[model samples]
Target: NSLAQFVFGFTESGRFGAARQTKNSLVINMSWGVGLGMVLDDKIFRGHNGFAGEFSHISLFANGRLCACGKQGCLETEASGWALTRMVKEKILEGSSSILVEKMNGKGEIQMEDVIKAANNDDVLAIELIAKIGDNIGRGIALLINIFNPELVILGGSLAQTGEYIRLPIKSAINKYSLSLVNNDTQLKLSQLGKRAGIIGACLLVRKRLLSLS
Candidate 1:
């Protein structure tokens, strides 16, 4: 679902105020897990078995956190919605205070949306954690930029809705980690298609396929 949306990012000219552009672009959808999609020369780049963008499981950390994929230190462990919830729990356990604690009201579950709400409301701890996640995400993106040198990288998924709260950190990390030449060629922007991106992408993909067959 996420990949479909990311693929549609290549067709976002109408929504994001630009003309249809970029045969080479990438999209990163950061939800409970991370998803990636790429358009190379106006075609979707699917690797062997059509599973090219399992980016969440990329081992980018040494934090000893186990991923659901049975791997340790995957990128998702540090830069995803699941990671946000985990970080919130750890912060509370360490006696850090936030509006999130009050919002939970002892329910003992901190959804990513709750944290975003707190951060938007000026909750320091929430913002701090989000920045950390963005930094980590940017690090991973730096690697991608180095390899793909894509013209654009679109940030999607629920986390992207955090706006500048997440964008600044990711941009900072990309600048810090990627080579200046390659980094300069890439632009990062939030998905303007919003939540509708995935469903819309799916429909577009189907239309394309059907047209191709005809």
Candidate 2:
């Protein structure tokens, strides 16, 4: 995996961040994309690459899965936006009976949100599909906890809207693989900020930067 094979290099050379300096960072490896961190001295730990706290990759694959980055076995292959959407498309095409199928006007042209809505309404196939994605998400998180060893993990983004269905599996996965010491200090929880998490998190960064200038 590129993440492991180049972890040290990325952490040092800003490979994971667009920033030119090694500032403290906040890495948020969401189910769909990768984010970097920039912290320093008990704060965000921005390595050379100004990317610290990123953990969307842990090689939890089954030895072979197609990734958009052209990687054969990355976490993105299993639980990312790419992965979830792929799964949804396949399930619908498989003739599965789901509200999603109905939403597509009896066709199989489903979108990500459609599946989420169908799942929320208790569609059998939708639930099964979501659970499958949740399982993969959990597996990815387990690898993340074992590697980054963070103290707290908050899951945010569109998928978070799925509610407990996503959290339960992720919690289960982390517990299954994290070392006792890591798990003891770490807590897995959903994002409480709702749709505002992204904007708020970004605003926090801006506020911190402005304060730093003061």
TM-score of each: 0.90, 0.74
Error of 2 at 100 (Å): 1.1
Model 1 Cα lDDT, one tens digit per residue, 130-159 = 999999999999999998888888888788
Best by TM-score: 1
lDDT per model vs. reference: 0.80, 0.57
**Candidate 2 structure quality by residue, lDDT tens digits, 1-214:** 3442232232222212322232332233343554333233335454565444444554567768766666677766777666776787677677766666565655655666776777788877767766676777766666666666655555655676788877777777767766777677665555555555445545555566789999
Q: Which candidate is the best by lDDT?
A: 1
Cα deviation of 95, candidate 1, in Å? 1.5
Candidate 1 Cα lDDT to native? 0.80
Off by more than 4 A, model 1: 1-19
lDDT for 166 in candidate 1 is 93
Task: Name the 10 consecutive residues with the lowest summed lDDT in model 1.
Answer: 10-19
Model 2 — TM-score against the truth?
A: 0.74
